[model samples]
Target: MPSNAPASADNWWCDESSEYAFMGFSYEVTACQSPQQLQQDFADIRNTFNGRYIRMYGACDNDGFYDDVVNAAWDNGIGVHALIWFGFDGGNQWQQRRDSLVSTLYSNPKAKFVTRGIQFGSEPLFDGVLSPNDLASQIWDLKGQVKSLGIPVTVSELAYGYQSNGGAQNVLDAQDYLNIHMLPFFDATASTSNDAWPIVQNNLQFFQENGGGKKMYFDENGWPSVTSEGVQANSGAAVADVTNEAGYYQLLEDHCSDLKNNAQGGIGWFAHIYSDSQEPGYGIYDTNGNKKFNFAPRTYC
Candidate 1:
């Protein structure tokens, strides 16, 4: 994919190995697979994808499964944005979580090097778990302790959540980057596939201004490849099909130039997931190990 914009090396977000952004995993759910199975899956991803970054959910607990995840990621030459899950307001449990996470990191210093960033929580506000001010204070306090470790930290929220007037503006004010999930297919207006990029572009501008001059990343974005029998319901809207799902990937490859150009404000856009799982819908690979039409082969542009 040749680009009208400067080369990938000139783009700030480009990794030495690939032009694509990070990959994501539903770790809290998927890591439950057998260690051998998970290791193989990790190996397959490293051998196939050009990108070196990955995003994972949940802390390093639950029988040390996340420890295996981190070890496998390091073994396969990938970095991770590890998340600490939050449900409701935790009172004293918040400090306990911070302590546990710190202990995990302390125990696995080698694996910790592979951690690209620390995500406090994923869509905490959307789930009505905490107010923006509460979330921001949490993020700021965590950053105070962890920032000295030399990695960026932030939270993930829906696209509009990064806006100046949105409930998560305080969270936006606390992080180093504008980390957002841009899912146009789920928008109430319910646009077609072709409208996805334009929707993304428009949201980026909104986020850029409201993010307090911080850089941004589409930490999660992609349409579900399943149709008919397996359509994942979107807050009660019609299910997205292959037409929209596959088109989303092609649209990304076709506009790689615009994506890398700093004129658009240099954003890193990660695909929603790596492989199929019990979660259903968004995987670029089926549970049978087949690639979906939306599986674009990423490479240095």
Candidate 2:
């Protein structure tokens, strides 16, 4: 019973015995925050929220940023959904990001344990910053480098981006799993409605139809509670009512069991964000560290 091996891939989501194997939240890095700061947050994500994954969005300029995250992540008993953000404007840091990612995997034995998987690019094709084949090639290249590490790899993109891009299917084939962004707040029909669950279902339907049945998961999905200090969200009939935020998350919490048990192999979702400071009003906790609601997320439904 005491034999030593990780309970999952790179300790993937969480140990098999974990109560929170299916929950996660999106974590963004605008700058190179200290490991102390990052560890504190990671501790909260794992201990307080019982989250098994943290989907990364952006990164600091430092080449060491990747490993910094990895080391801190495992230390807190949480795993990192490593994202080598290509950025929206498509700046030219391909070499840097590549090097950092590879090095991080090799730098520490804990690196792979903390890594949930590697997302080589995030929404790169949506803005035409990268071609489908080009993105796929990058994904394969990274896969080769990390073959020994055995980390699952993917390139995140919108459902439409995958549907419309000429070689999108190729990119989909290249990755080990489907990494898609499903945000109801952007949907015209859902954004204005009191109930976003229906639209969220539609979003998942879109992915599954084109997915060819590959395992899929949402890297981002949630509703913003506010657009500004006084301004409410303005997506047609949508207002700034803070209750809407809880509604979206509540649905996610409710269906966690269905997602894991689905025969189609859905990997579950990571909430859109962690705190309001990073994103105006999308956080579970506001700027003052007060929760918008009293409910907690449960991955097992």
Candidate 3:
């Protein structure tokens, strides 16, 4: 059977299969030429995806631009599930940026139409840029600010590397919501061992056991078909072709299964910047907005 073949209702990631639901795609707006243009693009996306929720981030520190994007999403009836207010290029002024973001959202009810959750920082622990307690405290403070504003908050970190060293525990202790970014790249050596699933499982288990009963979310997860350095082995040798796309789908299905009951939400790959040669093949839609693969065709049971 074809790998892209539609999975049945019995499939673990299927809408009827479990409680954990997958949020469609997390969009990046950096590629748009102008804020208005970006807003228009988002409007089209919202129409195309209809009921699915989309996660999005702003390009510059322009509140107006962010507001426009959010407004566009809302106008089209699209849900702007999560607002990644800070840390696009690893710049860590989370508190300041988040304050600005919250202020902007509150000032405009249209912007607030689609958002309540905020992603504080991305990959702080992996880069050894922020200490565990410090990161946790940041999350705590952000949550407090959002709650004081009468809205809920969520904190997301880079996957694999960021929370590798007790950072997960700290995040759990400090924040009620946890976000994980997951990317599955094929490695000849690692792929055989089913390394990806184990890592995801362990992280979920750790979070559940450590912090108070906070919810976990696979905030960002995807498989990339092309790499900057080209296809290579675990030892960095050139490989034949991009690993099977079917394998990618299978991995997603399995990961969704593991997160079925526990995960709060999920977001699939993405649909922008389809031409980044370095990270090619990651887009679910092509540069012209063609569907690369229908990973999830059904949204609900």
Candidate 4:
């Protein structure tokens, strides 16, 4: 995922006074050519989608990927929710990550203008690499450092994780907000694209009921058009893919239209992505920046 700098509601999708307060997307830069290209992409995303926020999955690396994203986002009036990678890195690695973040903020005098908040990691508990208590501790520890930089801190996890005993007592209590990744596609029980909202609604209910009613932010959600080999063999193959561009289009339209008004009652959502990637068939934009036939609903674009 990636970002754009913060802008007034006038510049974003939803009206400032509207009940629908947030509309955002996740971005990745693997298909970008240079910083200039990446910057233009951010500008295009803002101009085209009217999205105010972008979520990046991990910390900046020596390769300058995160650097390009931050610079582009700041220039294009987008807010970024940065996530730090914390699988098994040691204390030194964590310090380095912190240094990189602090440096990014310090170097950008106007960082407060574009920064939304921070997440300690994406799906640490869902992946089973970290226990619920461990994720809670990370959030508790990192919250101070993030606050020192003038940003809020939280962790992104599968919505179901929060329903667990530890999730309710530990994880929910440690974070400033709830950042959940709700991909019903991964659920064996989900039988169709239409099955998505019900799962999303249920998860939101779980968060609201067990989470002490913290604000909700869906870090990821979307349907893939093609059933590539990896996902094709999954248990829900019967409804895994929408099968064609038109079906995929309707799926997006229905999902977005319904979600805009908190239709399913989740406060807000970030569409799964901006463009296609190695993950296959999820991009709204092709590698050359061309919109797929069903990229977005007509009015949305």
Q: lDDT of each structure?
A: 0.63, 0.72, 0.52, 0.62
Candidate 2 lDDT, tens digit per residue, 122-222? 77787777778778788888899998887889877787777678648788888887777876766666454357778767767766666677777777767
* TM-score ranking of the models: 2, 1, 4, 3
Residue 191, candidate 1: C-alpha displacement in angstroms: 3.4
Better-scoring candidate (lDDT), 1 or 3: 1
- TM-score of candidate 4 relative to the true fold: 0.78
Q: In lDDT terms, which candidate is top?
A: 2
Candidate 2 lDDT (Cα, 0 to 1)? 0.72
Pairs that collide in candidate 3 are: 23-266, 126-162
Model 2 / residue 295 / CA error / Å = 3.8
What would the TM-scores of all predictions be?
0.80, 0.87, 0.72, 0.78
Query: What range of 10 consecutive residues in model 2 has the weakest lDDT sum?
Result: 12-21
lDDT of 4 by residue, 1-301 (tens): 2244443322333332242323566765335447897677678778877777787754445655556667777788777877676544444465566567756765664565566778776676655656777767767777766565557787888776655435546877888877777666666666566545566667766776767766677776666666676555244443644344335335545665454544224356566677765245666675566666544433331
Over the stretch 7-115, how does candidate 1's per-residue lDDT look in tens digits? 2222333342232333544343434666676667667766766555677644444566657766777676666777777645544554665566666665665445666
In candidate 4, list every pair of residues with a backbone clash: 1-27, 1-56, 2-27, 4-78, 5-73, 5-77, 5-78, 5-79, 6-78, 276-283
Write one digit per residue (lDDT tens) for candidate 3, span 204-256.
55556654555555555555555446434353432222253434545656554
Model 2: number of backbone collisions: 1
Model 2 misplaced stretches (Cα beyond 4 Å)? 1-22, 191-194, 228-235, 261-265
